[model samples]
Target chain A: MSGLLDVEGLVTRFYTEEGVVKAVDGNSFRLEEDEALGVVGESGSGKTVTALSIMRLIEAPGRIEAGRILFRGEDLLKKSEREMRRIRGKDLSMVFQDSLSSLNPTLTVGAQIARVLKHHTRLSRRARWRRAVELLAAVGIPEPAKRASHYPHQLSGGMRQRALIAMAISCNPKLLILDEPTTALDVTIEAQIFELIGELKEEFGMGVFLITHDLSVVASFCSRVIIMYAGKIVEEAGVHELYAHPLHPYTRGLLRSIPPLEGGEARLQSIPGEVPDLINLPPGCNFSPRCALADERCWQVEPELSGITPGHRAACWRAERPAMAGGGHD
Target chain B: MIVFLSKRLLLAIPTLLVASFLIFSLVHIAPGDPIQVMLGDFQDPELIARLRHEMGLDLPLLQQYFHWLGNIVRGDLGISITVQRGASVTDLILQRFAVTVELAFFSLIIALLIAIPTGIISALRQNKLSDHLSRIIALLGVSIPNFFLGILLILFVGVYLRKPWGAGGYVPLSRGLLKNLAHMFLPAVALGTAYAAIIMRMMRSAMLDAMSQDFVRTARAMGIAPADIVRRDIVKNALIPVVTVIGNSIGYLLGGSIVTETVFRLPGMGNLVIMGVFRRDFPVIQAVVLIIVVVRIAVNLIVDLTYGFLDPRIRYGGER
Candidate 1:
């Protein structure tokens, strides 16, 4: 059976003055209904680009060259702009990272939420406003009626983010793409946001495409996760299994880099090199230059993301061999 | 808001005082003497001195300033010495100011009508043919001087087309609205084109900025219609900065009206001030300049108040 979201062979590129930046190159993934799929990637690793591509929001100079974004058994890539718009915010919605920038400063929080309802539903203006307040209340905001009339700047950071979430779920979308939804909040607020997302997911039965760089966040919140590097998916697997045995070296490095809560090494382990420039990436594996086990063969040929275990996949020539000693341990 | 308004108004008293003092001092400090200009070839020292005493010009400069200030407090703006000899400066200014206000209002309407739509279109279609065309038009608008544009309009519409209303003149509102508008149209265009260019460029940049804002992307991601996104998200946000530019440029419009009035032969404040300067009519010049200063302060206050209306984040008084 098909999942709620199945992205196949997605190739998004930006044709800039310097060169064509392969932002998302031949990545494929599936998100089951009512499941939280975490997309973990560093900056410029095509996490946001992948989300934007799914939304068909790539502007000029940045085009989705190839992709089949199948949403709910319907190919979203094949839909027209009008059809895509109707599907967006109704069947599919997205929440951004920076709530302050994402919410219109000039418009009240309630009005912004009401606006989404205005377009997506047949509710009257008053009803839309009432529903907007209800959504705000549902998102754990205090005094929803009074808070709805307040502008984005008037609210605290956490509240603004909640308001944004309220807007995203205003129409009860089947798939909600959250791009680092709580990255700007404090740790406590971040945990609260995830809890709210968890509640909202259960309430709406929505598939969440949660994109972030925080692996711990993904481990705690997502059932499955994909690790992206240099605009490519380096690994994909169940969260628990992947954490127990991270097959790829880059994934191992990311896993090891997370600081231990109690007694451990004073310094955190980090990947050796910078993410390769998309325009002039290494000929072989994108992370080969940074891989300690990279040999002549690894440097000459790029590996396809192939199945290693029953439900785990990794794109590394070394993954076929036994797990490297002294690695994958916190 | 009331507290803000009252504070701004109270602050204006000192500003107006400084402005009035500068007007009085500068007009006095200038070389030309009103008595000499009025008497002309009849340069009798005794008669000139007598007239000077009668007008209080012979008094100590400080005392004369106070006398003038005292008269202004009583709604007296002194008498015009040369432009309209012995005419009450207050009545003369009121008549001319009405014409100037009507002209300025018409120009503002014309400028906004042309600038806003074109600016939005230009920004929406940036780097397109329409955008280039508008940019070119704006450049031409700024390049051509107001007097030259006015004369060109008169030549084209009056001399070439032979339209009765195209010739330089003014018609009172009582004459007929259409006739008055027809007469005011060319002058307004000439005075407004340059302002339209400035505002259009500002609007274009502001719109471009607003378009790139994250909120606009959020609106799009939420499935808001493209037109609604442009209207509700982009345009409203863009208008905030553009309103500031419009407020700041009102002074430019009033200043440009001087040349426009001269070319169009309208008896507005510009013409009155110009004639005042040429004939050393200190009362007319000083009164007109002082009024312009006061109007500028009031416009600024209105602009500040408008910010509260446009963006709720900008709270005034203790409500913040």
Candidate 2:
């Protein structure tokens, strides 16, 4: 089925003093309606950059070099900034990582949310304010009316995250892109925030694109998972299928790294080597330097994301070799 | 809020007392005897001694300081030692105080009007032609002295262009607001350029800093218009630090107005202080300096209070 949002061959780059860093190198993915697509990657894997590129929020020194972000069959890249602005926060909204800093400290939380409503909807000032308080209450913030008048600093970390979620869902957006939303919160608060987001998504019938590095967060929360290495997506599969029959070496390494509950003294496995420098990426497969399965073919020629099985795609050259693929450990 | 304000006001008492004591002792220690200055070129030892004795200057310095302090505490600023024999220093200062206040007020207005927009433009157009041009202009503005700028303005506008309003002069606002403003315009510009330059650089940097904040990105992502984001988010956040700079500059403006007034020949506190210094009018000198100290302190207090208004995080005493 055609997806609710489709990102095709997206390439985002940063022109720094050193060199042009290919932050996101021709990566493609999709999110179906009412589905949560987890983008799992290391810090510089262009996960956040991809999300920002989709949002059209990349600032100076960075530019989206090439991409077609099709939201509801409309090419967002072809839209003007004014048009994009109208699309943003109305059609699609984002929840940023650092909730406290992400919020405007000078403005009250209600006012910040109300401002977005004021821009998109034809609600009067008082109605928008009432809607803001309702959104806050819906996010499970106690004393919503009182809290609405409070500045970001006055609230606890969890409350601020809730406030941020309230703002993101203020317009009942069609798609919500969450960029490491729980990275700064404690584990319990993180879980609560995710639960809140999940509830909001259900209530609003919104598609979610969850960008995170936490495997467990993805394993439990996402329906489909995309594993990225460097600036490219290496694997895409149903979350359960990917976990049960992992194809990509990087994805296997990621699953192995998750510490088992009720364990038998099993050592947590970690991938060797670091993410390659984007400005000076090695030829062929970007993950070759870190992959144990790398052969001359893997080094000499980059593998395209070919379907290993129905609904499962991987870019690794050894994907078809079941002997080397399933939980391949040294 | 009341507690915070009361605390600040109570704190000012000790500050003012210490400042008054310092001024009293410093004036006493200053060279040039008031008696000698008063009877310039008419040297008579017996007459000088009698004059010193009558003025109570013959007492020990500490005693003289306490005497002045006591009088000041009792709302008596004493009399001018040199000017008009026994003219009340309070009345003399009151007569000229309005001019300095008017000049300072206009200079601040000019500074804010010039700096705020230029700073915003320079920051928004950073690394572009407009940014570089404003930086160069700010540099020139900061380098040139107020007096030099006043002289240049006079030379160009008054002497060369022969504009009636360009020359150094003072017209009381009571005479006519527009005419008075016209007369003070050049002086304000002269006095304000450096201050404007200072505040502009501050605003530019502050705006640059504020623009990088996550909230600004959030604002943009929220689909608020770019202009609205700059106005509602960037400018408000940026103004927090810029407000401090602006407030501090008012103190600078007060001091700077001294040279500006002397150059422009306005009958302001700066002019009075200059004359008091030259003629060694001890009471007038002492009182003016003390008043300036009080004004500076009050300005700082106002700045501190304004911090709360600008930043919700910095509420006075407790949360609202």
Candidate 3:
């Protein structure tokens, strides 16, 4: 079956005065319906840019140079802005990271939710408000009626996030793109938010495009994962497969960086060196500067994402070597 | 809210007292003598002394201040010294204040009507030709003096066009609303243009800030119509800061109306105060200045209250 979202050879760039920043260089991924697919990367790794490209929300200074985002087998790029407007909140919705800033300060949380319903649904004003309050309650907010009248600042961080989620899911979108949705929340709230999203995915049967820097978050919440580096995907595999046998050296570094649950003398390992500047990236693989296993060939030529074990892929020339198959963990 | 309001009102008392004291002392210290101006070329020392005694100007400065303060507290603004001898300063102010209030009110309306839409458009289409045009217009509005603009308006609309309502004059509201508006419109435009420029630039920057905020992105991502996003997300949030600018500018508007009123030949507080200053009408000057200070205080209070209304995070006196 065709996937719910298929991004093909996407290249998004920002034309700044400095240079053209290849924010999301040529990369592609697919997300199945009702499946949770996580995009893992450190900051400036083009994960957010990929999601924005799909949403077609890239503004001036940034342009989707070349891409085909197929949603439900229809080319979204081919759709008119007016048609895209109808499809956006109804068929696709996005929840941003900063809940407080993501919600309008001047409007009550419910009124903001009702606004989405106002455009997407034919519900009456009163009915939209009622539905908004209902959505709030469904998102686990207490005293839905009273909370509906409260502005975003009046609510706690978790509650505000819940309000944002309620707004995103108000129209019952088929695909929900959550960009670092729990990054601003505490650990406990983060777990609860993911749990809520998991439940909502099942309830709504919505495919989730979960983007985060945290490997553990994807490990817990996503069934399939794609690890991105700089502006390209470095690895793609099933959650268990990726965790047990991460093919890419960058992915291995990420997996090793996750602190073990049982506290021991093992210090958390960090991937050394910063994300490369997109405007002036080094020759060969973007990760070569930081990869310990990077050889002469790795510095001279970039590698394409090639299948290793069936269903597992990595864009590393060294991944095919038998000695590296064990997936280093110390 | 009530507690906050009452506290602010109580604070105004001390402020008004200080302002009144300053006005009284300054007027008394100034070289011009109302009696001398009133009895021009007469050279009657005995009459001047008797008149000064009757007016209680011969009393000690502190005594005079206390006496005037006492009368002010009792809602008595005293009699005009020379501008209109024996006429109640309170009555004179009341008559002239009506005209100024109308002028200021209409000017504000004109200002908002011009500033808001243009501000939104300018911000929405930033760096575009329309935006550039609006910015140029706003710059002109700011750069050109109101009196000079007033003269240009008179030259264009009054002399060149030869329209009956184009010339400088005041029409009482009692005559008719349209006639009153027509007479007030040009002066209002003259006074308002500068404020419009100020408010427009404020609104433009504020809108730009609002547009770049995360909430606006969320609104757009939700597929809310572009118009709706602009209205609800951008404009609504943008108005908060712009309201503050508008509130602060109201004081400027009232002050600016002085020149605007003079140019337009309107019998407003500006004209009254000018006459008072020239004649050294102490009571008239003191009362008019006092009223202005009070009006400014009241406007500031209103602005503060509006903050709570605009942004829900602002709760007066910590009330939920």
Candidate 4:
């Protein structure tokens, strides 16, 4: 009957030479129990930083300057480093990007997985070993019992990602954050990963936070979609509704940018102007500079996330009702 | 692997030849002759000529180098002029070289004891008071010459502890391990303290670098205990660079121990070389230098092989 995670007014900034760069500026969202939310954005939209801030993995010069991240109603920002560490594995886990670099190169897959078990469970050595093998098998690695004994280098990109997944889900965490989960793999492996996630999500009803730039993935698996721009959520709605009727200019632009495959020409449309620099940003709206329908009001006023319908929001001054058909201006 | 060895081997030939050339030239070019130093108080010019002729001092420079190289290849480094019926330079080195090895072994042990924990703590608490304190300690070690530190340690041990500095002679490690260890501690520590500082600083930097790697974050996300992260994740990855520093430290220790030995009044290889330098004993100096070079090379090769064990990503010949 309630949300598994509730992040509100989350503002993260990096103290740099020029000025504070608001990496995640007053962004907020939530995931209900057993829900999967996809975050789609261009680079510098604070996609990764938002995920990192939730995990309390922000390093020096960069820190959560304001806001609350409530996991199961416990304020995560107030937790001690040690406490946050415990929550990271036991409650919320992350399947990191770049499995080649994410997996410890020195340790075997089994040893790496065993470490997760060791952290959250008080299992004996034998129990940990068996559990590591079982987790590896669950992730669909071939000869898992033996494969777990091999180091990260011995595995291909897909296998390394599976090992990362095995480690992430080891504790049956309430939430799993997959940052660009299938972005590094080929189509077949990507399909395997989507299917594996489906299987695991069914087995353990953990909420999923999928962060990627791929719009297709949101269409495929996400229950809800949150579109971000310049470190702020511009639009949020159910996956079906958002794709069919993206109200925010940025979201509409992104949807139209995906090229089609066929005999016809595939030239896609794109929004002009790069993402606004977080440091020394122009005052009012960040996306206003690139907006097509910008007015004096758009440049002078900061648009807050406002509901256009129940459970749907868009931070746009000129948002209109979506057409009944798939998203289009006609 | 063979290619690497061949490369190392080809590189070593030039290195060894350059060393041989320098030692041979400096000894010959210097004003005083070894014959004069050996037959001191001899104003007789005829005896000097006879001795110089017998030792092949009359040969041209290039001829002498080839002759020496040929003999060295045949395992006959020229006989020691100082010691009567002077043993082959290699044999004399082998006998005395063990003492230096034993001392270096103790130094490495002492260095490890001081470095590993200090470095790990420094990196784990990076930029905190303890980390600053460790940095200060390392800086002081780097700033102050080891010879000054050596002298200070000897004085501290003598004026305060009331332990005799050079009264007990050397005890062979094989005959009595405990006695040998106790006897070597003061000198070894004097030599090892600098190495410890070096290794500690290198390890701290390496661990700091490793700590920032993605897998380290991955390990943290796995909720691995801080201690386990330091041990299994941080240290394991950090070890490669540390090994390189320590391998290089071996050369520093053996080369620098000469001054420390002089300060402590010990009869180690350093002291022996200093004595040979005063007496102008070319054979003993060459033998000592050669032994130091070979031992350093051995340590480096051992370090290279160790890299294979430390990181699976590093293979001897790399991946096919």
Candidate 5:
């Protein structure tokens, strides 16, 4: 499949007061057109950094050191700020977490959506407003015309998230990056949001880069999943393939830790150690210290991501060995 | 909205009443006798006692208070005791209050003009050379008091430059708006600079907070121009706290204008109050202080209403 977005050797660093933090170190991945790609990692695993780097939204003390961000075969890094401004919300859009904070507090939800249309489209004010209401209704908000005039704080959490989604999809962007869009939402609302996102992706034919720590979310929504640890992607495979036979130790740990929701033993499994400090990551492999199967060679030299099977890749040295099959989905 | 306005209006009555009582008691307790000040060098004790009786000071404190309060309810502020002998306090205040109001209005305008832009620029270009330069200017503005700044303006722009407009004097707007503004400009600058500095600092911090908000990032991600994000989102959201600061500082502004007007020799309320204090004009002092309190209360109410307007989540009168 032709890649809609290809990120190659992306290195994003933050020069904080403590030290240099390699937040997203040498991350490489691709998103095909009309495909949903999942990026799974814990809190400090640089998943958000990767998405922000793609948007070129990194602020002071944080810089994208080296990378070629190719969007539909066009190098995005070469674009100036002005050029990027035009491309954003038209060609690329992002739905951030924390809907309450993501939406502007002062402006009405309708005005906020209309603002995006005003920037990207040639519609008149009335048409822009009508489109805003249409988008709200599309995202499943009740009484779109009435709700559009309400401020963010006046709306429920689910409604606010829906409004944010509406705004992100206002211009029918080619690529939509959702950064843990359901983290602050309840489970029922989370399912609804994912369903809405799925429908929107189908309707608009847009590529989605879904970033979350929820493995189940990735399993249910993303076709291809990439597992990251200490800012490096350690495993990449189709969702079913990865869940069935996780090649990397970290991925296996993550899969084992997903508690069963069926008639089985309720013992919860957790990865043994905390994520390594990004500023002073362990040598060889960032995950080697916590890796249960790491050997002397694994401690001395880092392993590259090698093809384990036809469409699966893992960075662990033991991928060649027979896969242990206990963590398969029920 | 009607319910809210009426509630606020009802609340203001007791507030003004309490303020008047406090003003009368505080001014009376101060170490001065208005009759003695009025009858300077008169050695007749009977005449002094008679003057005190005539002014109602010979009665019990509560009785005198109630008598004054009763007259206030009837819309008579009594006669100025010394500053302008036999002039009605209300008339004296009415004449001078306009000047103070005008000064405060122009000074506030100046402050807003200086603070809003500087604050926005400082925040947008944070840590840059221009931001640093603005910080230095704000520091200077805060450090140098207004009266001292007024004197400096007089010396440099008025005396040294020999510019007639720079000298200290009052020019009523009735003569010429241009001349009046020129006459008021120096004092307004002096009075406004410190407040501008205060507001500028608040704006910078508020803008910084607003800029870091998720909405700003969303705006940027929406392909909105940087200028539009700042204008539509950052400034409007940032202004909520800054408005509170501005509203709360109105009292301080009125107090500062007292000194500012004195230095500029403007016949404002501040000049009236200062002259009254020195001459023990009890009626003028009480009336001016009461008027100031009322104005402050009204300003605070307006601020609350404006808050409702600016933030839709803050609903007045139970309307969702």
Candidate 6:
């Protein structure tokens, strides 16, 4: 009853040409009903895979190696693809990043929305059509009925995103997976998207597994946050707790990377180097090669995720006494 | 779309011109004189030389090409070197063209009908028993030469089935439609096999790729059924690529079906060209080659237009 979604030790990999990419290593988290949890990381930090894995949308060459995706205490991984399809768009749904490409270009938005209502709910044609318009309006699409008749290509990017949001929230699923849902928009449009997600969450009581590479979005919108690096969770804590006392160096690096508005200039620090390639990953801590405090222990054996606070976890040898950062330590 | 097409067309012009020149020059280049070949070796040398000179073989190669090009621009293809009742090359072209067109057209229909569904099913259940079996079938279709397949089909359907089912021979669609299909089946299968493999492989891969796209995943996530996913989402997205392969294969269908046509004793352009080549009927060969070239060019133009229709993103005017 307490946790609406409990994911533990989720592991995913892909047999790619380069090698077997350990895209998502062991990671665990929980969300209360209607709670918004943010997953933050740079590109290739297992952020998208974790979101896709949650949606059960990981394609061939990539699969759920081992994991327990418990949705309201039921193991989702064990469900048949058929049963999973039933839950998708009803019990759980995902809002993908490429909003324009994510929509079927040939299908009218109304028909697309009507399909879910038809499949998941026993609504009459007229009633479902009415509900589609309402959902479109709820997502702030102007001229709901008129715009609904248009194909995805006819709508602007922002409108297409809203359509996707409308579709995701159509069934009022228990969990909504948003994988950089606002990444494709401009800053001005980005604000509108965040506001939409916020409004939709309040209107419909549902868990939101919001995946994004932008730390600022997580800082502003997420109740709890998980910071990942090199396919594994490096840090997890309540948003305020992590912001007040960031434990992992990678977390500290990421927070420092974000420039503070109305204040610091050279304070923002870009973490040196990219996310380590998952294929042929280094021994010990995957982040050790990039870590400033890499030592014999950090380089010899991997640090297990250990509790730094009641619920906050950090996988670092120096988790207890990590250096504090200047407001914008660029 | 226009930019891609203009570039392709600009390239095609040189190609057609070259093909036309080659066909014309082929008559002159052959060891025997064209007039002698037409009038036979018994004709006097002076009359043979006079006929060749009149036919313009005595002109320079470049002059011959320019004269041919000029005539082509005026909608004229010179008289046939050997033919009945003094029919112009163009007239003979029109007369024989229908039979070839009908054969190629029927073969193309057979190819699409067999290939598309097989490809879809193969992709939908990839690596399963049916899929593996389909792969085997498609492989056999690919490996066995089309002419040989055509001969077998004639034996089985035309000879064997005809004995049991009644005497078999082609009835044009304009004739009794049902009987026409029955008569055409052997030739169609023979001509269609090569293209069938190509279409099947392209469709299967394209369908597989389309099924993996986010839009299709979104479609399924929206609770659309699997069959509908294939029809609406997967196959639709897969078409642009599939169309390209199919368009290219049509050339093989029309021009390359020569062996199949010969085996089935069908009167297609392939058979015409083969006969013309052997008998040294210079004008017939030239006319047939030119017509095939033009048909290929026209088919390509249609394919280009089709792209714009299928995807609005494709602009036929220019890159802009």
TM-score of each: 0.97, 0.96, 0.96, 0.91, 0.96, 0.86
Residue B109, candidate 4: alpha-carbon lDDT? 94
Name the lDDT value of residue B303 in candidate 4.
Answer: 84
Q: Number of clashes in every candidate structure? A: 0, 0, 0, 0, 0, 6
| DockQ, prediction 5 | 0.83
lDDT of 6 by residue, A123-241 (tens): 99999989999999999999999988878887889999999999988998878889899888998898998999998888787788889878888888999998889899999899998
lDDT of 5 by residue, A1-330 (tens): 449999999999999999999999987888999999999988999999999999989987999999899998988888899999998988999999999999988999999999999999999999999999999999999999999999999899999999999999999999999999999999999999999999999999999999999999999999999998888888999999898878888888888888888965877779988999999988788888988888888888888877888779888886654455454455
The C-alpha local distance difference test score for the whole of candidate 4 amounts to 0.84
Please give the ranking of all candidate structures by lDDT, highest first, separated by commas: 1, 3, 5, 2, 4, 6
C-alpha lDDT score of every prediction, in listed order: 0.93, 0.91, 0.93, 0.84, 0.92, 0.82
Q: Each model's DockQ? A: 0.82, 0.77, 0.83, 0.61, 0.83, 0.34
Higher-ranked by DockQ: 2 or 4: 2
**Alpha-carbon shift of residue B133 in model 1 (angstroms):** 0.9
Model 4 lDDT per residue over A154-213, tens place: 899999999999999999999999999878899899989988997898899999999989
TM-score of chain A, every prediction, order shown = 0.97, 0.96, 0.97, 0.95, 0.96, 0.95
User: Could you give the fnat of all candidates in order?
Assistant: 0.80, 0.74, 0.85, 0.71, 0.83, 0.42
Clashing pairs in 6: A267-A328, A267-A330, A268-A330, A269-A330, B1-B315, B2-B316
DockQ, cand. 4: 0.61
Clashing pairs in 5: none
Stretches of candidate 5 exceeding 4 Å from the true structure: A323-330
Model 2 segments more than 4 A misplaced: A323-330
How large an RMSD does model 5 have? 2.0
Which has the better lDDT: candidate 2, or candidate 6? Answer: 2
State in Å the error of residue A187, model 2. Answer: 1.4
